[model samples]
Target: MNIKGAIMRVFPEIPEFDEVDFSQYSTPYAAVLIAFFESGKSGLREFEEFVEKNGGTKADVGRFLISIFQYLLIRYRRYGDEKVEVPAFKVFLTLKGWLNENGFENDYTRLLHSFVGYLVDIAEKIAEKSDCELGLAYMKTAYLLTIEAEETFKEEYFSELKKTAQGMVAEIYRKCGINGGLPEKREKGC
Candidate 1:
């Protein structure tokens, strides 16, 4: 195969946004996404496995996959040429790229197996570079936050979460392709 042909054929399957209704999701989705992203190296596998293991069974998985993509795309924008510079996510991106090169193998639901794999690869590289222990210590903390964030989304007050999360909320909003800047007119509140 020529280089262009090989590139096109390498991963025959590209995820289709077919019926993803992102607008239907509430604010907590963004909150949960921020938590997943904040977890960095410690939570990559947890999120990836959650998406992969539940592939095709749950409706939320598709949303979850796209949420992750948006998160990384924001990372791509935030860090630009340095998205892989983090000591945790380079491992994730590399491994994900490897998996894609191998084949676009997906269980049919989350369509995010590849994306998750890539995140893990980047995380792995970061861990190696930083020499941080990717162990239960951080895992427990990361998941605790994730679970809490998930719950906050299910509550009636879920819409308020984005305003309450401070930096995490802001990052999540940015990742979701929303350019949340200062309000047009300054409010009394800071």
Candidate 2:
């Protein structure tokens, strides 16, 4: 099936899929990720509009998160060279605050756990393909560090989180066989 068909199958109830102009994005997954990030940037008002347009509930948002992660997993598995962009810690804090204020904290927590588990499975697959145990370990460590950073952001521990997240990104870059350590500034589309 096509990308749009796959996305519709994954998220049949999201009306935003119908309204979103996917031509600007190279892939449907990219479109969804951009929408998600845009919603977070807009204090979730856009997300609320998406849900309302689709006649969905907060529970659907949780499902949407899972779908996004699942898409990431698929893309990574199919094209091992694809770099997964880890959002900034501030994005997590904003999303967490929005979930708390909007009464979806529990759902978000559950979905996060599921997402991490999926990452674990993906890491294992990647390891198997590359025949490198250390690579898998690094991938898993990066994922755990990311989760830790997100979890601790509410306590104003962003300095430490930023450091850890940078380390995680470096590890991911290494695992992907990208040479030349973290740049002074990450290039766009990296």
Candidate 3:
């Protein structure tokens, strides 16, 4: 999506702002993001306090925070190259939340779908590294997101993505040696 470019276009004042220094703000960003996910409004105050504590000037903190969030999502899909502060699931949650809040839910449905696909792609990459369980978890989360989108937006495209996510989940399950369907029992085998 070239989010960095979009940020540059939106905030020309921060013209010299290079790549987001995620490492410098990862802790606070994760904290405020988690707060936002939980309590919604509190995150704003927390974010302000964080900026103040971090010695940020009188710039647009709100927009800066949103940029950080959007960058987080952008980086999350980059897989192993970028160090994402928030978890993968939380990144998807925040992206969806941001879209809904900014009235882009309907307009950017395809972007959301692409993010879900990226999640699945990342999961497959993780599975290739012999982490099938984690891959399955991510695929399941993608499936859940697609289902929510289908129910909320009533779009046939989300339904198709849901089916694709389900197939991905099943593929990971097979890789994990579970055959098909849910596991009947948990066995502690060496």
Candidate 4:
């Protein structure tokens, strides 16, 4: 089977994460992620309009976060013990906290668990369907995060094109936390 076929094989039967499957991302899954990540004020019609206006893909304002941060995650194991202040796990933890503060109903553990679980599930699906020896899969995981930033941090998303992904993520975490949602755990790890 091809890579896209592999992606379809692992598609989640559950609505939330299942809709995020890379292949379905062109339609149903894509729309769901857009609605979930975009503003509560946005309607399905509006989302479609945005997509139409943006030339097929949703006009994700924070599109680069996924690409650059993904690099960080893949490289984490190699750098975990090198005394780097922000390992990928830590970055993920921080992102989890941010997700929680943004009302994801999660702490770092739950957030990372959900996120990683989603990724692993997709990877398994892809492996099952595809014959490719190796693939950079998560790059396909773009629509969700950008839609998230577009809704949650419109200014930050549009203000800079070349800022560090680490800084952008940290800033998003802070703002989303301070936006009168759940207070982040004051612990250093949080």
Query: Which structure among the candidates has the greatest TM-score?
Result: 3
> Model 3, range 90-172, lDDT digits (tens) per residue?
43555455555656555346556556555556555555554766666556666776666666566687678777777777887
lDDT (tens digit, per residue) of candidate 4 on 56-124: 542241122132234444433343322211223333433444445544443433333334433333333
> TM-scores across all candidates?
0.23, 0.35, 0.48, 0.22
Tens-place lDDT digits, model 2, residues 1-190: 1444434334444433443333322442345435545444232455556665656676565555444544444544454423332211222333455566778877556544434444444444444445344554545454553455356344444344445546655666676766544434324367
Q: How far is 5's C-alpha from truth in model 2 (Å)?
A: 14
Candidates sorted by TM-score, descending order?
3, 2, 1, 4
Write one digit per residue (lDDT tens) for candidate 1, span 1-190: 1221221121123222221222322333344444444544223335444435534223343344344345444444455533323422322333334344435324221323223333333433333343223322222222233333334345433333323333333433344455644222223355
Top candidate, metric lDDT: 3
RMSD of each: 18.9, 11.9, 11.5, 17.9
Total backbone clashes of candidate 4, pairs 3 or more residues apart or in separate chains = 1
In angstroms, how far off is 124's CA in candidate 4? Answer: 27
- Counting clashing residue pairs in each candidate, in order, gives 17, 0, 0, 1
Model 3 poorest 10 in a row by lDDT: 1-10
What's the lDDT for all of these models?
0.34, 0.46, 0.52, 0.33
Give me the displacement of residue 11 in model 4, in angstroms.
34
What ranking of all candidate models by lDDT puts the best one first? Answer: 3, 2, 1, 4
Better-scoring candidate (TM-score), 2 or 3: 3
With candidate 3 superimposed using the best TM-score fit, by how many Å does residue 14's alpha carbon deviate from the native? 26
